[model samples]
Target: MSPFNNHLEVAGFEKILLLKFSICVLFSVGVWVIYTQKARLSSIPNSKKALFFLLSFIILRILPFLIIYVILDFSARSDVRMFYDSALGALKLGFVYRDFETAYSPIFPYLTALPLLIWDSAKAIVLEMVLVEGIILWFTYKYYKNSLGNYYLLLYLMLPAPFVFSILGGQEDIWMWAFVLWTCFILRKNSNWLLAGLIMGLGLLTTKALLVLYLPALFIFAKKPWQFMLGLLIVGIPSLAFMYYHSELLFLSPIQQANDPRTPNIWSVLHPLTNGFVPIGPKILNWVGLVSIQALGIFFAIKSKKTSKPHYFLVFLFLIISVWLMIIQQSSLSNYAYVFLMPMVFFFGEQTNKKWLILLLLLNLFVVIQPPIWWGIGMPIFHSLSDLNSGYKVLEYITEIGVVVLLFAFLRIIIKNFKTTNNSNV
Candidate 1:
């Protein structure tokens, strides 16, 4: 059977199963090689190390997907199709939210559609995402080279979540963090608060609206709060005015998304008990989740205010996003964990204990595979209350439990690191 829906039947990609298994083996070997050769790699020039990292990422993450989908004509599956449809819709309508319905922010559809102008295929969207991921990875390496070292890049590439979600699934979640990181990079000198804020606001416009959750923490951590606020308002006011004039659909998009509850969230776990019915309804749950996330962001901001270390800000950022994934109504999929993968790896990768690192790897594995199980097994067979089966129910419960455990594991790591950092300071 072809992976991701019988590509054997549709796309006629021969030996696809072998191809996939080979890619998996190769990725495992690549990771092992990097791990064992770390000492030798440390002695190499930074430029050479950077080249090796990029090449490894391409060979492991990019080439396999390209070979399967582009070279062999395997059909694009999952959210990439939706991304293509939204982009095509926006192209046809000449407007994103006004002309067609999309849950994404105002600028995303346009950005996705740009590639379609030349390539005119869904593959173009995947390639566009790959390009963006590459740029993000380059910048990440550049920014963290001195502090975290090249191992961070290698670890990030080795993680299955980024490859599965960003390259294979074509998710835009990581783009949100890419923007946040770029903002941090801009303000690394502690002199560019206004520019950083403008960049961040632009990121919010282009990426998911949830990126706003990072604002409170960012404001608290910023050296010049007033300047950042001014820059944010500069971009935000014009963007809001343009959105209001262009599309009433923009305002209605979030409400529309709230009606459907996704899997691997708290709501999904309780869905079996509720029989897909809640007394409060999904909209209320949506607001409640948002408020809860915002409250946590504010709390973390206040708690970490005294600590000016950049990594702590990232920890709080990861914490806030973790809370969002755990409780948010529309966050239904674990793939959104891509947003926090950077901080998780950067902070937790240095652990002397292998247990936390091992656990993190297992969680990444769970996250990478959860979407396929939910989509292929749970959604198809157990979508409706009447359709549920005992075996499928057990599998669904296990996946949900994995999500909950992953959330708690992240919280634990964050707290541990926080205390360790403070104690070292003392």
Candidate 2:
């Protein structure tokens, strides 16, 4: 059975089943290898094991998906195509925002276009992403060697959210997370506020969602604010210059995006009450989300300033940003929230709550079963919600509700930690 679903029938269905089974086998064997090698996978000689784990993931996990992408050549998501185009456009003309239309920060075009200096194709974009992921994993292994075990590395790669989302979906959120993680590592390990702020400023230039982290991160750099501000200005000035030049196009994308109907977010719950004006509802919710996130960010930032465990504060800041990304953004997909996983592995280590991890993994499973939300298969089967049955509708609703619940859980943890800190002070 061909895995490419054209008619959505049993035609070539056997091939699809075989492919699925092969992927499962590969994953199981990969996990087995990690477990078998756990004894020797300690900190001193961790690189070889980390590299082995990365290769195994690429072969067992990513290779099959690469084959699938080849068979269904253009079935990949649009973000990569958009990135490729924006990058190419930036190279061909000028900057992406000044010339093309993208909501991404100004630096993304340059970053994406950097690859085009040697190669130019959607495949090249994915290849560049693979290299970026390899570099990120190497760094993660380096700073986090003491805490990160073979099992954590294996699971991080195999997890459906990070694996499929990064490889197949072609989302740049993974790259953003990698950058942010590296920044946090620098801040925590070296207490080098300047370098940390510089990396974070670059992160902000990659994705605006990083803004939610800036204030919270400030708490960690409070003693050396001047050096941090200097670092930010060094990398942030270029993007600011462009924004100053093209300030007119700045709000163009946001305005257009907000006018669309809400998706799996808090606004979606209020959308039904807004009549046909649901398209304009995010205009209000966007501001509300911003205020809410900032208020929480400031509170956590202050609380973090008083704590010795500053790294945990970074984790909470990441969680806050993830929640804002999940709920506040006018346009969001489930994969956007996986940025938390990078911090989760380092912070919780092997002692992390397995039940919650499993729950999050289960939520990501919904993406695999459901049709691609942002891809076009040249079939009319999944073009709209109307094309899907009431069952799919229910699934979508459940996914949204689950996100809200998760956001609330993180908020509760943040509040509890603050209260505990207050009592300890007294």
What overall lDDT goes with each candidate model?
0.67, 0.57
Clashing residue pairs for model 1 = none
* Residue 223 C-alpha lDDT in model 1: 66
Off by over 4 Å in 1: 1-33, 146-148, 270-281, 310-315, 327-330, 378-388, 419-426
Error of 1 at 403 (Å): 1.8
Candidate 1 yields a Cα-based lDDT of 0.67
TM-score for candidate 2, please give it.
0.76
**Mind giving the per-residue lDDT tens digits that candidate 1 earns over 70-164?**
78886766688888988988788567776776778878888999999999988888888878887877776666634345666776787766776
- Cα lDDT of candidate 2 equals 0.57
**Any residue pairs clashing in model 2, and if so which?**
1-12, 1-15
Worst 10 residues of 1 by lDDT: 2-11
lDDT of 2 by residue, 1-426 (tens): 323333344343344334433443555455456545555654535447756766755774467556766656645454788878788878886655557766577667777788788866776677666667657766665555353455566666765555655666566666665766676677666678788778878777676544534454464435677777888888877766767677654523533554454455656533443443444343666666667767767766766676544444555566666766567655555566556665455444343354545554554454332224212222121223343344334444455567656655655554455344322111
Cα error, residue 335 of model 2, in Å, equals 2.2
Number of the top-ranking candidate, with TM-score as the measure = 1
